[model samples]
Target: MSITLSIIYLISTITFVIGLKLLGHPETAKKGNSIAAFGMGLAIIGTIFLNNLEVPIFIYILIIVAILIGSVIGWLIAIKVEMTKMPELVSLFNGFGGASAALIGIVEYGNNQADITQVTTIIAAIIIGSITFSGSMIAWAKLNGSLKKDIRLPKYNLINNLLLIALIVFGFFIVNGSINGEIIIYILLLFSLIYGILFVIPIGGADMPVVISLLNSLTGIAAAITGILYDNMVMMVGGILVGSAGLILTFAMCKAMNRSLSNVIFGAFGGDSVAAKKGSTIGGHIKKTNPSDVAVLMNYADKVVIVPGYGLAVAQAQHVIHELEELLTKKGVEVSYAIHPVAGRMPGHMNVLLAESNVSYDKLIEMDDINPQFKNTDVVLVVGANDVVNPAAHNDPSSPIYGMPILEVEDARSIIINKRSMNPGYAGIQNELFFNQKTSMLFGDAKETLTKLVQELKNM
Candidate 1:
């Protein structure tokens, strides 16, 4: 029975590896998710029935019922959630993962405290999992607009550093048997949660992708710690995979934005800096154009690039924009989407949004690949994107996003930006691109404006 269970665990671990590899591309991501889920299901079955732990029938029934309820709720949420809310949904799910790991540590601590190794693992799990849970919840709130403003306490970085040191010292004392009280663990958990909230609440929404990824990595590390306590091979492997992948992605996102991990955590960027920018104004003449004029420009263009952003998702205009793409394609004009690494609220957000509307995968060119093409392009239609394409990234050293890499849309022959208004982007600074001689703004909801543009294109 032990051999059979080991074989099952091995197979499950293999599936996890395979699934994760398959997840690298958008085309196979769904398949990879299903494969990983199947592996997890296999692992659970092996643990429940194959393991010789004679559990009570009622406990088994309770587990099954809990699984059913959770699965139903998850399914409902996934189906009903709009594309615009996907980032918060992901943040919420990451929090649940952390909470689950922390719960396991709490429930198993007493049972495993006799062993020094188990005690260390449990303590580690509790700290990391607690922090991940609370931090991810705060991230979810910020992403979903439930927390509209960043709340920065006085000397927040100093406070956070002190709290972190305290957590480490407490954990070290507990591991060394200096703090033997059962209540001590609970104290650590409480402080860890507080630290998590403080860690995230000061960060502005612009930096949420990195935060989400970091929290996800923490959850994975916590899961691995719990797996060590339980001697679960499948769990350990899965956790490691998740932890490493999320960590790598976090660094990639930081690099894409031309920021460092330490800066992201301690800089508390896009909060106070952006708030100050809100009171300031950019001096320039705003050139405005209507759908007909923009449509005519696009119709006569040799090549056009479309840039999608958070506003495009909010307006639910992916389909309309896809229609516009198709219309231009039929008119002998080449159309492609220029996707910035951190374009939307989360990683790969723009790609997913366009994919939902059945946009060709090949047409969604990434930032580096498309930037040089902008010079040769006739028209660049920015659909509700602001920060990623803002010229401030290049010329304005005083701007918050000054050092970040941008879309370089200014290089195009003509730039037409669609937006509801001249409001600033997530960075809370005006886009200098809007005032450039070759750029014109089309003001309205993206969906309404795109629909009008498509109609105008058809007339042309």
Candidate 2:
């Protein structure tokens, strides 16, 4: 039985590796997800049947019923959630994973008279899992705009540090077996939950992606610790993969924003301090152009690069934008998408949006891949993107986004932007691109503007 379970674990691990590799690209991501889910299912079934733990029939039935109920809820959410709410959904899922790990720790600790090592692992799992759960929930709320402002107290850093120190001290006592009381355990759990809330509440909505990624990593680590308690190789491997992927993604996001992970966590980049400092506005004349004139420009251009951001998602303009791309393609004008790593609300958000519209994968270009093409391109069409294309990131030393990497749309011969207003982006900073000499703004709903542009091109 042990050998059979081991073989199953090995096969599941192999599938996990292959699925993760496929997940790196958009074209194969869906297949990757399905393959990984299958692997996880195999692992769960093997564990239930082969672990040889004495479980009552009633308990087994209850477990199966709980799983069925959870599966139904998850499937409903997956089918009903809109693309725009993907970030929130992702955060909520992370929270659930974390909560599950925490519950496992609580249950295991209660049932077993664990050794010091086991106690230490269980405590670590509880703390980290609780933090991930509460932190992810806060992140979800912030992303969904239910928590409209960053919640911070006076001397927030000092208070947070103190709470963390207290948590560590309590953990130390628990690990040493000096404190094994249920009350103490509950107290520690309460403190960990509080720490999680405090940890995420100060982070603003703009930084939710980074926070979400970080919390995901924490949840994975917690799950890995739980796996250790159970001696489950499959669980450990799955947890490690999730933890590593989340960490890598978090690092990539921080690098794209030109911010350190510490800065993202401790600096509170999106909080009120940063907001108060954003008094400086870009100074220049605003140039407005109609959709027909913009259409004419694109029609005559040798190459056109389209940049999509959160605004594009907000207006659900991806389909219309693809139509415009098709129209441009028919005119012998080369069209491509310039995607910034952190362009939309979450990672790969623009890519997902475009993919939904059946936009060609070949035309979706990464920042590094598409930057060189911008210089020779005749026209750059920015559809509701701001910070990703802002010149302030490169030119203005004082700008909050000064060190961040951005799409060089200004290098193109001419620029056309589709936006509803002359408002600042998620970062709450004015974009100098909107005021540049070669840039022309087409103000309206992105879908409406793109629809007009497509119609105008067809008329021509």
Candidate 3:
């Protein structure tokens, strides 16, 4: 890179780092996103100008049209998508990132003169980007519940590991100039995709936040490898930032759940779908309470803490939930939100929903910040939340979720859960929190139930 280009890369790289740093807290996340995006735009412009392209005018026209189309489609999706479906949207976006990186490597390799080092970079980019892309798509499928979360077959673990090794070996052959290896390349891609699907298959819904974080890291690795191959300083730095941040967050989540990456990757835990079926009846075991009754309890309580989960997002009840919180606060009751590390479909699903709804950022407390406080809370409001509150994590030795950490909401003075029915949660486990002595179930739509509670609280 020239001196001038080096300066540009440095400025863009700085912006990305600062943006990521600002994003560590919710209050600055929006600004962080905008800043990061600006940096990326600058990097792209810098590259286009510096690449010294001698392409035809029609090629330029084609590129412009593609960008416009992509921008328009992305905007439409952003505008219309419900918050409940954000996880799938995120997965889709992540998959695109990985796919784009891998394709860039392929095209670069195809258009270039070959040597050992260049070929190594090409191979690295292809292998890493393919894994990232496929892994991300599989995560999308799992979050969308399109694929069942289970082992899917006996000894699948061994088979998947062996296949991953085979893919690695095949990649080496492609890099070493194997004769007409294009067919082998395509086949390897197929195997990579299948490996990703099988890898995340045995991981239940409870592990999705970790899965998302891990995939984000993989995407970053792919981008970094591509950057190195292309000798792009900005790309390399930006990719490193993303990779490091993602990995740190992933590690934190693993620790929060008292789990290791290997345990989660190998699906040693989080399989609870059959727990409800084999266990005692949820209704017969737990107290069933109405919304109005729960409303009265909330109105009477001195403090209430709302715990949200994937179901709350599915119901798109964050705004309605805010109204309930507002109503409680008006009644001279202290109200706060307890956000778990794996609260929703993604890592920060609850935070994003609440932030979008203009909920007070200060009201959203992290798991550690709110766990001790939950014990003192007069009424713990579980708004369509499940798995996170399960007591099995605390005491069940043989439980699939054993050794995992959970909210201590079961220790609250009283608990009110709003849900449609006693369906097992995505982890496929019966939440013992629902059956606690102080817990009461309010069966209905989260949005409507919260709305009803707000009205009832107003009357009170």
- Model 1, position 397, has a per-residue lDDT of 85
lDDT of each: 0.89, 0.87, 0.79
C-alpha-based local distance difference test score of model 3:
0.79
Candidate 1's error at 133, in angstroms? Answer: 0.8
> Pairs clashing in candidate 2?
none
Cα lDDT tens digits for candidate 2, 1-460: 4888899898898889889999888679889988988988988788778877788889888888998999999999999998888999999999999989888878777866458778888898889999999999999998887887787888888899999999999999988877787777788889999999999997767789999999998888898888788777777887888899989999998988889898877886645655676645557798999988987888889999999998899898989999989888988999999999998988789988998999999999999999998989999989888989988889888777888989999889999998899877877787878888998999999999889889999999
Best by lDDT: 1
- What is the clash count for each candidate, in the order shown? 0, 0, 2
Report the Cα lDDT for residue 72, model 3: 94
Q: Please give each candidate's TM-score.
A: 0.95, 0.93, 0.91
Least lDDT summed over 10 consecutive residues: which range in candidate 3? 269-278
Residue 384, model 3: lDDT of: 75
Q: Write the per-residue lDDT of candidate 3 for residues 8-95, one digit (tens) a residue.
A: 7888998899888888776798898899889877876676566565778887788778878988998998989887788777778888
Q: Which consecutive 10 residues in model 2 have the weakest lDDT in total? A: 273-282
Q: Give each prediction's root-mean-square deviation over alpha carbons.
A: 1.9, 2.2, 2.6
Q: Pull out the clashing pairs in model 3.
A: 272-428, 273-428
Worst 10 residues of 1 by lDDT: 272-281
The segments of candidate 3 whose C-alpha lies over 4 angstroms from its true place after superposition are 1-3, 26-28, 148-151, 178-180, 272-284
